[model samples]
Each structure stands twice: as C-alpha cells, then as structure tokens.
Target: MLNYEGIAASKGYAIANAYKLVHPNLSFSTMKIGNPSKQVKRLNNAIKRAVNDLNKIEEVVITNMGSASSEIFKLQATFISSPNFINEVSSVIIDSKVNAETAVSEILERRISKLKNAGNGKFVLDKIKDIDDIRKRLLAYLLNKNMSDLALIQSPVIVVSEDLTPNDIIQLSNKNVKGVIADLGTNTSHSAILTKSLNIPSIFGLNNISKNVSNDDLIIVNGMSGEVIVNPSNELVKEYSLKITKYNQTEKPLDKLKKRNAFTKDGKKIGINANISSPKEVNLIKNYMIDGIGLYRTEYLYIDSYSLPTEDEQFNVYKNILSSMNNKPVVIRTLDIGGDKQVPYLDNNDSSERNPFLGNRSIRFSLSKTIIFRTQIRALLRASIYGNLSIMFPMISELNEWYKVKKIINEEKRKLDDGGIAYKNPKLGIMVEVPSVAIMADQFAKNVDFMSIGTNDLIQYVMAADRGNPTVAALDNPLNPALLRMLERVVNVANAYKMDISLCGEMACNRYALPILIGMGFKNLSMNINSTLDVKALLSLLDYSLMQKMSEEIIKNACTVKDVIKIEQRFIKI
Candidate 1:
C-alpha cells in the first residue's frame, strides 16, 4: 500500500485495476505531414465523427443521468458550439483553405491573437488548455483528417493521467468510470470542481502513481484518506471491505435524522441551512431537510460566459432558485471573484498574490468596480420578489464599507421604482470573515438582519494562514480558541440584537463543530447539501445543555484548540 494525501474532490469508494492514460510521448514538431487535400478531407471527417461520438455520449448521459445530470452536459456542448468558439474555428478553416492541421492551428492562433487584443489575456489562455489536443488535431488534419483517436476503455478501471480538462471530465460521465487519479491538479482546477460535482472518487497531484501500478492489478482507492493499496491480498481486501461496510451502516442511522428538526435535548431549534450555486442544487433543499440556503454563490453566472450575463439572464437564475425552493430563504451572495476567477468586463487589476486569499479579492474587487456591483444588486433585488431572498455582502469589515453597499442597494431600488421595474426589498446581511468584522460583530449585528460567520476566511485571516498553500493547511482550524471566541461574540451579539446568525463555510459541514455551534447559541448552520443530514444527526444525539456548558468552559477558560477538541470529544457522542 502506497499512501498519498490530497483534498478529496469528490466522494465514493472504488476498487479497480489501474488503467493508466499516458500522454503521448510524441511532440508536435516530430509529426509527419501528408498530402494537403487528403489531410483536409480527413480532418473534416474526423471532426464530424468526433462531434457525432460526443453527441452519442450525450444521449447515453441523458438516459443514465436523467434530466438533472444531462443538463450540465448539454450546457457544456452549448459552450463548445457558441458563436465565439465555433465561428472562430470555422472561419479559420475556410479562410486558410490549407490542410486541416494547419487550419486548426491558424484558428487557435487567431483566437489567441483576439484574446491578446482584448487585453484580458487570462480569458484566452483558459479556453485552449489542451495543448497536446491542438497538436494532434492539427497533425491528423494534415496526415489523415478523417481519422478519429477516440477510444472506448473497458471499466472497473482507475483512470490515471497527466491532468484532465473540464471537457475531458464531462465526457467520462455515465461511462463505467470507477476512479480517477491524476499527476496534476489544484483545488480550484476546473477538472477537480466538475469531478466533485459528478460524485466520482478522485485524487490528483500523484506525481507517479501510474508508473508504479500495473493494469488489472486489484487496487483500493480510499478517497477519504488518499491511500491506494495495490495488489492487496484477499484477506486485506475483506478487512477493508468490512470497515467500509461498518461505515456505511453507521451512515444508515443518519437517514432517520433527515426529517427531524435539528434541536438539542433542551428544545433549542438549530436551523440546518445549505450553500448552493445553481438551480440544479435546489433539489438538495428537500432531499437534505435543510432550513434554507445560507449562501447562494453567484459567481458561476458570470464565469462561464464570454460576456457579462444580461440583467435578464441573472434574473432568470436567481428567480429559478427562489421559486424552486418554495419560499425557503436563500442568502444570495453578490459576486465573490478573485484569484483564479476573473470576469472580463470587470477591471480586476489585483495582481496574483503570494497569498491570494488574504490579498485583494471578493467584495474589495467588486467595490473597486461599482458599475458591476450595481448591476448585480439590481438583478438580485428584482429576483427577491419571487421568494425569500436575502443579500449578503462578502469581505465586509468597516462600518463605512457596509453602508457603502447599502447606499448602492438603496440607489438601485430607487432606480427600479423610477423605471417601473418590479422588485422586493429583501433584508441585507454581511459576511464576518475578516478579523476586524469578527471583533466588531456586536455593532454589525445591530445594523444587519443577520450575520453569517465565514469561518473559511476568518480562520485564514485570524491565523494568517493561506488555505491555498499546502504547507499552511494544517493550521487552518476553525476550532481554534481564537475563532471560537469570535463565534461566541458574534452569537451573543445576534442574541442581543434579536437578529439571526449562522455559519456557512467548510466548518458548518463538519459534524464535530455542530455541538460547539449549538452550544454557542448559534441556531443556524449552513453548509454543502450532503452535510445537512450528517450535522443534523450529530445535533440530535447531543444534549444542548451540556454543549452550552462545554462551550462556555472553552471560551471562559481560554484553552488551546487541542484542549477544546479534547473537551468536545469527552462530551459529544460522535
């Protein structure tokens, strides 16, 4: 067994033979070119065939994945077919009238040129990520354009690769894909995000797993632990299989907790909320028995498009989510973009930071460009009419900054009324992530309808830990006494102000933190969809009075994080 660790991008268990996908050792410069006319015709046929193959794959996904999953694939195909993408390629092929390989290269070069001209250099680079594919497509066009390199792999296989693009990952869905391990990928990589969404087990940054493991060797991939056991003896497989069975059995009890309201023994109701980005995730609301969506990340509406989404486009998305949840409150966070996410229309001039999380990003970047913020505020306000919508500003700290957003909201409302546009004035809230905001939660609670503690950032800010940096990840603990003190203060303020408060970050999803949250009088916990039931179960099992006492002891005694963890374990049954 060779063990490696990485953040589990998705969830599941798989035992399969390693099916390594080695990158072609060959380079573009070494490939041979044939007769131009034959190559052109061959390349066109190959494109046609590849398109047809993709279409068939889509149909298979539609049947297997049903309506919900199929929409994602269809949207991806639409992206490929967009005028900005397809037209550029077609025009290049026609205008150049060269061999298919040359035509594809010319098209790519022209697109790169256009991107350079546009001045958003990042946008063009993000589009054509598969450098090897470009080379092969060109080579095939020149030599035998009609040739198709697509091959169907037999399954119960562990897919090993140098890296995977979003398009490549999408195409693998509903096929007998068992597991995926890659040589390279970051947490925010498109491939990682998509794989997580698909619920497939994956491990990336494996440096050389493919070279060591042979095809058809029985291997167990523990995604949760990031361990791979190759050629495990039968006895070892059975032992691990039993362990997995026991874990699954433990999970079965959680299902019974789904419909039960998450309240402690003292009858305190803790609201279990969810975080969602798309309409497709709305189904999670009912399935997970969540109180509402605590955070509705709106960046996806802008990231996937060539241009800024029209007010109507944004309106449709917000309205769809609102209507789908049947009036459950959704805290629609205004665009939180920085680091890897860059909107073309927005003048995001923040340089890549040595520590991107702590640097200029989120609300700071949005406020720098007021026009973008105002447009989004207007759209969100208009959508509020359809359901229980609340606006939460990200990275807010100073009082002046809070009011700055409020001023824009007020102005947008006035403009809407002036233009006879329909909208509802939803309550606004702020995310308490920066240490400044956490310290001033009392004053902030007095102004806003609610305060959501974004622990992911708060810990990053408080510990001065950059979560993106692997070396510092161990230090990113929300259970730290410093953070617990902040949460206590935030909750106490919310109680004083007669306002609601919740946490909507990675911490909310963790079962161990539920006792502490409820103990601190935080009745609302928002997290990813799958974690709702798990947290609910943990909440149901604990005595609220004991948790409260335990929480107070930690805050009052000023213990370290380890001490708090020990105290929590001693009290909570989990």
Candidate 2:
C-alpha cells in the first residue's frame, strides 16, 4: 500500500478507481483571422450556446443542492448576456480582424488580467476563476471542441485533478461522483467549498496525487482523516471497505435525528444552528433539525451581482429567508465585507493596503461607507417584519464601533418610519471575533441583545497567525489554552447578563471544541448546515456534568494545546 496525506475539505469515505479531471486544450493562435461579419456571427452564436449550457448546469445545482449553490452559474449567465461584455468581444472580432474564438479568448484574458491586479481579496480571486471558466467554455463552443464532460459521468470513481474549478465541481453532482482529490486547494477555495456543499467526500492539496496515480490504480480516500491509500493489498482494502460500510450505517441513523432536539443525557438542551450566505440556503436545512439561521452572511448578496444590490433587492432576499424559517430565529449579519472580500464600487483603496486583513474591514468598512451600510441596515430593518430577526455587527473591536452601528440603524429606522414603511426593531448583536470584544464581553453583553463568537477570526487574531499561511497554521488551533480561558469568561458574562450567546465558526463544528463549549455554558452552537446532524448526534451521547468536569480540568491544568488535545483524546475514549 502507498499512502498520502492531504487537508480534508469534506468528510466521508470512498474506495474506487481514480478518474482524472482534465483541462481541455482550448489554446489557439491569437493571429487567426476570418471574415469580420462571419467572426461576429460565430461569437454571437457561441455566447448563446454558453448561456444555454450555464442554464442547464444551474438547473442541476438547484435540483441537487439548492439555488444558493447555483449563484455562480447565474452570475456567469448575467455576465455573458450583458451589453458591455457582448460589445467588447464583438468589437474585438470586427476591429481586430480576428476569429470569433480568438476575440473571445482575448476579452476573457483582459478580464482575468484586470481581476488579477485587483489585489488579494477573495471577491477578485473568485472572479478570476469564473472568467477562466468562461474563456474555456466559450472558446470550445466557437471551435466545436469538447469541454469537460463531467455531466455524463456514468460509474462511481474518485476524481483526481491538479485543480478543480467551481464550474467543474458543480457538474459532477448527482453523477455517481465517489470522491474528489485535488493537487491544489485550501479550506476556503471555491472547489473545496463546492465539494463540501454537495456532500462529496473530498481532500485537497495532495501535492502530487494526480501525477502519481495510474489508470488502473485503486484508491481509498478517507475524507475524515485526509488519508489516501493507493493499490492496497486485499486485506487492507477489505478493512477499509468495512469501515466505509460502517460509516454509512452510522450516518443513516444520524439523519433520523432530524426532528429531534439536541440534549445532553442529563436533559440540558443546546441550540444547533446553521451558518448560511444567501437566502435560498434555507432550503438546505429542510431535512435537518436546525434551531435557526445563526449566521446569515449578507455579503453574498453584494458579491453575487455586478453592481450593489438595491434596497428592494436586498429586502426581498432577507424577507424570503425570514418567511421560510417561519418565525425561527434568523441572525442576519450586516455586510461583513472588506477583509477577504472587496468590490470596485466601494472605494477599494483599502484593499491595496500592506495588511488589508488588519486594515478597513467588516464593521470598519461599513461605517466608512455610510451609503452602503445604511442601505443594508434599511433593508434588514424592513425584513424584520417577516419573522424573528437579530441583526449582528461583525468585527466590532470596541464599544464605540458598536454604538456607531446602532446609531446608524436607528437613523435608518427613523427614515423608514417617515416613509410609512412597516419595520420591526430587530434584536441587536455583535460578533466576538476580536480579542478586544471577547475581553470586554461583560460590557458589550450589557448593551447588545446577544453575542456570537466568530472563532475563525478570533483565533487568527489572538494567535497573530494567518491560518492560510502553512508556517503558522498550527497556531490557529482553538485548543490554545488562552482562547479557552477567554471563551469561559465570555460565556460566563452572557449567563450572568441573561443574554443569548453562541459560537458560529469552524470551531463550533469541531469535535475537540464541543465539550469545552457546552461545559463553558454555551447553549447555542452554529456551524455549516451539513454538520448540524453530526453535532446533534454527538450532543445526545454526552453528559453535561462530565463535560463540565473535563472543561474544569483543562482550564486549570492544560497550559498548552498539546495538553488540551491529550485531555480531549482521553475523554473522547471515555
């Protein structure tokens, strides 16, 4: 047996022959020329076909996943049909005296170049991938060549690739895709996100898995542990095969937990909620016993479009989510942009700063750009009338930032009142992602209706390490003794103030952090939609008293992450 290690992107188990994902040769000479009118006609015809192809993929995503997952295709379709895009490509064909294929390639390259120079934010980086897909797809149509045929996949196989784009990942859905292993991807990569959303067993950043594998190589991918074994002997294959079977058996019973509320054996209950981006993501929780939408990232509403979403457009999306949940608690976070996200319209100068992550971002960016902030606040306020709503401000490091957001929200509410618009006063909250906020939780709790610990940022900020940087990624562990102590203090404050507090981050779904959270008095835990069931199932098997005991020991004796991990491992076995 040959073994390889990788970063786990999505969790499951698979044993199958490897099927390599390919990047088709769409390369063509830019000097190729044709009759000007003929080239323009071919360009128009290719655009129409590409749009049709996108629409079909969008349908597949919506049917198998949800409409939220299909937003990429919608954006593609909109861009392709836009007047500016059409004009630019057609002008290239006629003015440059080039073939339609060459014209499309040139325009796509120009767009990609523009995006590449748009600094390092995820918004620009994601668009680079989107435009790359468009370039290949359109050129293939013009040249009458085959693009990826993932949609036509017949048998179950583990997909190995140098890198899989979002467009490639989407079409592999409902097509017997056993697993996805990639040579390059991170936890936040679009391909990684898509695989997780589609519930496919996947691992990425395998270095050379794509190059080493052969046509007949049998692969066993354990997405849970990020392990891959190639050409294992009969005994080992049988062992791993049984593990997969047992894993499936265990998962089946977890689904039956849908209607059941999560509670400790001692009868203490905890709220299990989902972190979502778009409004249509509510559809993803229909089969699960989700307490509510804990973290509704409103950033996608702006990110999904070419221009800023108007007040009406934002309001409708918010309304749909609230109405769908039927008065269930929906905590809508106001545009948490400018950190890893950026847009050209929003004075993107800050995005070019030396340390953009520490620069203007989240609530900071919102306050600086009042129009964008107020527009979003007004829409969120209007949507409050539809169902239970809690509006949250993210990355508020100080009390002053908290006060500014509230003042602006009140100003918006007043304008709504003057306009005779019906709106509800939403329960206000702040994310405790900043160490400053976590330390001052007592004071912040006194002001806000609730608090949520955004551990994704909190850990990185507190540790002074970027999780994306491999050299310092180990520092991002939630098991760090100082973070646990800080969380204990925050949870204690919330309990003392009688305020609702929850954690909505990757930490919330992590098993190692589960006991510590509940033991520290957290009654609410919000994570990705698919993770709710696993957490809920584990919640039932735990005893609140034992968890509290274990937490007490770790808080006192665990001075390092290694100590905490050791304690957790020992307790997990018990």
Candidate 3:
C-alpha cells in the first residue's frame, strides 16, 4: 500500500477506483472575424449559456449545501452576466476585430493582468482561480468541447484533480463519485466547501496528487484524517471498512435530531433557525427541526441577474419559502447588498465609496431608493398571508433610520390597501450590526418587534476590522471582551422586554460561543442549516441554567482570548 497525507477538506471515508481530472486547454490564437455583429452575437450567446450553466449549478449546490457554499458560483455568474462584462467583450470584438473566441480569450487575459496587479495574497489568488474557471467554461462552450462531466459516470470512482475549482468539485458530486483528491486548495477554499456540502470525502493541498495517481487504480480516502492510500493491502482495506461503519454510526445520531426539537437538559425549548440566502435552500432544511428561517438574504434575488427581480417574482419566491416552513417564523432581511456583497445592476450602488462597508450599505442602500424598498416590502407583505413572515432590515445605525424605514413600510402597506390587496402585518425587526444599536439595545427594544445580533459585522465594526481581509480578520473575533460585553447587553435587554432576540451571525456557528450564548440566556438562536443539527444535539446535553451561571463569570473575569479559552475549558470539564 502507498500512502500520502494532505490537508483534510471534508470528513468521510471512501474506497473506490481513481479518476484523474485534468484542466482543459484554454489557449487560442487571435483570428480574423467574419462580421463584427455576428461575432458579438456569438459572444453574447456564449456568455448567456455560461451564465445559465453557472446558475443551474448554483441551484444544485444550494439544494445540497445551502447558500454559503453556492456563493462562489453565484459570484461567478454575477460577473459574467453583468452589462460591464458584455460591454467589454463587445468592445474587444469591435476594437480588435477578432473572432468571438479570440475576443473572449483576449478580454479574459487582460482581466488576468488587472487581477495580477491586485496582489498575490490568498484572496487575489482565489480570484485568479475563479477567473481561470470562468475562462475554461467560456472557451469550452464557444469551442463546442466538453470538459469532464463526472455526473455522467456510471460507477463510483475517487476523483483526483490538479486543482479543483468550485465548478469541478460541484460537478464531481453528481453521483457515483465517492471521494476527491486534489493538489491545490485548503479547507477554506471554495472547492473544499463544495466537497463538504456534497458529503464527499476529500483531501486537498496534496503535491501533484493528480500526477501520482492513474485511472482505475484502487484508492482509499479518509477525509477525517487526510489519509489517501493507493492500492492498499486487503487487510488495510478491511480495517478501514470497519472504521467507516463506526464513523457512519456516530453521524447517524445527528440525523436522529432531524425530527427532534431543540431542548435544553432542564426542558427549556431553544430555537434553532436557518440563515439562508435563496428560496430554494428552504427545501433542504424544511425537514429539520429549525425554529424558523431567521435570515433570508434577499440580496441573492438581485445578484442572479442584470436587472432586479420584479415584485411578482419576489412575491412568488417568498411565498414558496414561507409556505414550506408551514407557519414557522421566517425572518426576511431586506436587501443587505453592499460591502462584500455587491449588485452592479442597481443604479444606487455607489462604486465610488472609499470604504463601502461602512457607507451606503444594507438599510442605507435600501432606503436610498424608496421604490426598491417599497417593492420588496409590498412583496413581503403580500406573502405574509401565506405563513409566518417577519421583515428585518440590516445595518440600521440609528433610531431615526429605523423610523425612516418604518415610514416606507407604512406607505407600502397603504398602497397595498388602496389597491385592495390582502396582506398580513408582519413582525418588523432590525439587525443589530452597528455598535450604536447594540449600545442602546434597551432603547431600540422598545421600538422593534425583535432583534437579531449580526455578529459578523458587529464584531468587525466594534473591532474596526474587515472579516474578509486576512490581514486583520483575526481581530474580528467574537470572543473579544468588547464584543462579548456588547452581546451580553443586547441579550439582557431582550430578556427584560420578553422580546424575540437571536444571534444570526458567524458567531452562532462557533461551538465554543454556542454554550456561552445559551448561558447568557439566549433562547432563540440561528445559524446555517448545516450546523443546525450539531447545535441542537449539543442543546440536549447542556444544562441551560448551569451555563447561565458560568457565562456570568466569563463575562465578569475573562479579559482576553486566552482568558476566555481557559474559563471555557474549566466549565466544559464539569
């Protein structure tokens, strides 16, 4: 048996034959065009087809993994579908007077140069990979050639690739693909996220993993430990086969929690909600005992196209999601688009902002254009009659901002009433992302129906660090004394008013933070659908009352990350 070790990307065990996936040749020489108009038409059609393929793959990913894993593809589709993209392609076709393929290859190559200038950091490197994927998709379609479609494979095989793209990893998940071995990517990469979403045993960061393996070679992949064995001895295979059975036995218990409600040891019911972006993800989590859809990221509705989704279109999607929950609460946060999430189609998106994250984002952009805000509110209100719907606004930094948004909602409601449209009144809420709101949580609690602490931004805003940027990403810590204090204050106010309060940020997914939040008296908790079961399983073992007392000491005495860690370790041992 020959063994190799790499970074574990996804947890599972697989024993199958190997299939090597190689990158397609995207290089093409510039050729003279017959007609500029015809070439432009051809380029446009190719782009449309590419964007369509990305969209379909995105839906499959969302259904399989939820919205976060699907985001990479969504971004790729948004880039290709933008007017700016087509305009540049058209300019190249006319200016260079070259064939459609040559124009595309040239434009993409020029983009590569601009991206290279951005820097060689991990983020830049990831973008380069994304561009490469886009380049491959466009060239393949234009040239009428097929790339490896693992979905078409009839039997199970372990895929080995030089560098797995989001496109490649997702396609590998079609069926009969037992595992993935890739030479590039870390657990944080888009490729890794796709493999995990598909529940494929995958190991990335292997050196020339593709070159070392041959097609139909017997392979064993242990994703939990990042172990890959080629042509293992019969004894070794039998041993791992038992381990796989044991591993699956442990995982199936979490599946039992699918139909089980989340309750603390003391019989206190805790809410476990889903934070999803697209309506389609609702189908994946509906069977789980999620309290509700805590956050419906409406920005995805805008990112999928060159123009905004019409009121009817938004209404239908919202209705489907709300209906699927069957009277369970659904919190739809309206248009949190800006910062890392951008929609170029909207005229109101201010590209010139020096620091876009802190300026004209979320509620600010939504309010900047009342028509856009009104249209969404009208849709949400119309859909409210179908199930329990709560409308939440993001990035409200002031009481007046909340008041201004409420005024717009009132206007939309009146317009619906005037048109004789039947709509139920939804519980109105605001995301407590800004420090200003968290500082005055008590004051705001009086004005809103509920509060959801979006710790992803609150921690960053409080710490003055961008989570997306690696240089300062560590400082965006949920365990920071400052952030913990702010969170403590918000939950206290929510407890005082008997209002529905929940943590729906990245912190909610943190296992360490979970017990602390529950101890701090958070009955309502929301996180990604993928993490929901684990959180619930943990809930049954936790004594909420005991956690509440432990949280008090951590809040009072824990001063640093190390301090928090020490105290949590002591408490967990109990």
lDDT of each: 0.69, 0.81, 0.80
lDDT of 3 by residue, 141-176 (tens): 878776665645668899998776434654675668
lDDT tens string, model 1, 75-153? 4444444566545555545555544555566666665466546643234333332333444544554453333221245
Instruction: Rate residue 427 of model 3 by lDDT.
Output: 98
Clashing pairs in 1: 42-145, 42-146, 43-145
Residue 320: error of model 2 in Å? 1.1
Ranking the candidates on TM-score from highest down gives 2, 1, 3
Query: What TM-score would you give candidate 3 relative to the actual structure?
Result: 0.72
Index of the highest-lDDT prediction: 2
TM-score of 1: 0.83
Ranking by lDDT: 2, 3, 1
- Regions of model 3 farther than 4 Å from truth: 1-30, 33-245, 347-352
For model 2, the stretches where C-alpha displacement exceeds 4 angstroms are 17-29, 32-52, 67-96, 105-133, 140-174, 183-194, 205-218, 230-238, 338-351, 568-574
Better of 1 and 2 by lDDT: 2
RMSD, each candidate, Å?
Answer: 4.6, 4.4, 8.0
Clashing pairs in 3: none
Reference-based lDDT, residue 16, model 3: 92
Q: Count the backbone clashes (under 3 Å) in each candidate.
A: 3, 0, 0
